[model samples]
Target chain A: MLNYIAVSTIPIMIFIIIIVGVKEKKDVYNLFIEGAIDGLKIVYKIFPYVLGITVAIGLLRNTNALNIILTPVIPLLNKLGVPMDIIPLMALRPLSGAASTSLVMDIFKNSGPDSISGKMASVIMGGTETTLYTITILFAAAKTKSLRGTLIAGLLADSVAIITAIILINIGII
Target chain B: MSKIWSCIILISIIIAFLTGNPNAVTSSVMSESKIAVENIITLTGMMCFWSGLFKIFENTSLLEKLSNKINKLVLRFFDKNELTKEAEKNMSLNITSNILGIGNAATVNGIKAIEAMAKVNKSDKPSNNMTKFVLINTASLQLIPTSMIALRTLYGSSNPTNILIPVWIVTIVALVVGLVSISILNKIIK
Candidate 1:
């Protein structure tokens, strides 16, 4: 079923593109080439930025940096009765969406999807944005040289989501 | 990004060496190298495909038609018709992409949208509108979290859609809080 949907989407997209191209009398092939070139350029531009972040994430994970760092903060959150399992996910969510997602998938693998922690992971993942990624990529692209109040505001919102998710679960809403 | 990334990797590597586990860094790079290349390839292709489509969308003026409705809401929210044309268009497109859960595509426009906003403001420092743009952009209200739903289904959830309500509620609250606070901060700071 998933395959069917995936396959259908591409053809449907192609069909629409072709129709639109014809309607607009656009040079579809050339426009496509131009877009591909632009895309490659953007990917090239961001590749180093992405590599840097990915390596940092990988090394941090393997070296247990997050674990070590979170140890001190864990007690505080623990005192609030936030589930221990999803703590790493919360810590990583603002860093990279993909990284935290891989962590959430790991949670699902270790525990069933219906588990309390699993639901919480899903909620937090969906509710919050990748704050660091958002700030880094957008601000960098815009050449906003300074870290401004935006970061604080976004992180504050994420914390609200985190607290809300925990509250909802503890109250048995999920 | 450069500063943040360098600080993180540098600190991580230094700590690894100091802890006598430098090999961990090597292994991480080796493993991540393959995955990162594959991801970058996929991301590049995905971006190309969408950009091509959006190019066509533009040529056909379909984008204009589609964004027309969304721009109404944006105009009302921003409470002005004084937005530069490019800014208004980018804002509508960004919102449309986010609602459709095309996040990577949304980022391209999000950057463009904010830049456009800043351009209109004609100020070096972020104006209230620009700051508000980043706040809501990061809050990222989504109608369909495609990745979340897929992950849930893969995990054998009987009803994967169950996460939708919680996600919506949380996101809405975040959006509200972010908007209100950013506006308040804007007044206080500037």
Candidate 2:
């Protein structure tokens, strides 16, 4: 069951890791500290990206700016049987995982978890990438020269996810 | 990057001013930054725990073992001899973690893989293989949708895993479409 796997995955991993560490005669605790510190540094590095996106999205949402920005596409999307409410989630999903994540929470809170729209939104979030964030941080870490193509392609894939999620919902598959 | 960042702030300010709710921007910025900080703070513990466990996995060469096991399969996605050995290693590990549904490790491997590729490629722009790598990560194929199911359960879905079949279907379709699109674009552009 999903619940069991989700609940126990970490503990199982930890158990296996401890055994492997002992078998290798390794100081697992210290190794973990080192990795933890690295994680700390990573969080520090990526925080700005996360914060900028959140602030931008929060402002748009609080000021009702997103509605105005998205209003033009609403009619067409509606005609396509796309759920009116999830369009923003689709647009933002590839942009910022944290922001779209909070949006998913909002949908679940308001729509109830069992609603088709809620389930569909959850599926989209799960299936797609936080494309911009991943590309930016990874390319920066890699020191790659090409940034534009990655972002564009990532966004294109995200659009595929968006359309696929909508169609599945329309077809009553989810 | 600077252009997009500045444009976002500028647009937010203009929207606030035109909407006659300038205070909303300030309040929202403050609250959202707080949320972001909180998000990081809470995730830090879990991140640390997993990172530590992964290190043990890495130190004992378990990662390398798994990486080697999948190396042949991973190579099929990439060109033979196009990537350096280091790049291939990272890519194999990345693909393995992705298939296992462990997103965190997948990302770490992805970045490392790109780093390896960058070292080998002398060009300034993204190399062909790097573009494929990005698309693959974007449409990652994993066995479990753990996070989504967890969220669904947290929100009271009786059958949180109901999307299991649909998620796989959509992800695979997205992956195939993305690969085809990128390959076409690559040919047209190059």
Best by DockQ: 2
DockQ of 2: 0.48
lDDT of 2 at A15: 83
User: Please, what is the whole-model Cα lDDT of each candidate in the order they appear?
Assistant: 0.72, 0.74
Tens digits of per-residue lDDT for model 2 on A89-124?
876787766567666765676677678779788778
Clashing pairs in 2: none
Model 2 lDDT per residue over B1-190, tens place: 4665577678878988998999998899998888667655645565565566666667786777877998997778776667988889889998888776666678888998989988877877777788788788887477665556656776788877777667777788778877777776776655
Interface RMSD of predicted model 2: 4.4
| RMSD (Å) of each candidate, 1 decimal | 5.8, 4.4
The DockQ values of the predictions, listed in order, are 0.38, 0.48
Candidate 2 segments exceeding 4 Å error: A1-52, A81-85, A95-118, A132-152, A169-174, B1-45, B81-84, B101-127, B145-163
Q: What is the TM-score of each candidate against the true structure?
A: 0.68, 0.74
| Tens-place lDDT digits, model 1, residues B26-81 | 99888766555655554666566656655555456665566787888876768464
Which candidate number would show the highest lDDT if scored against the true structure?
Answer: 2
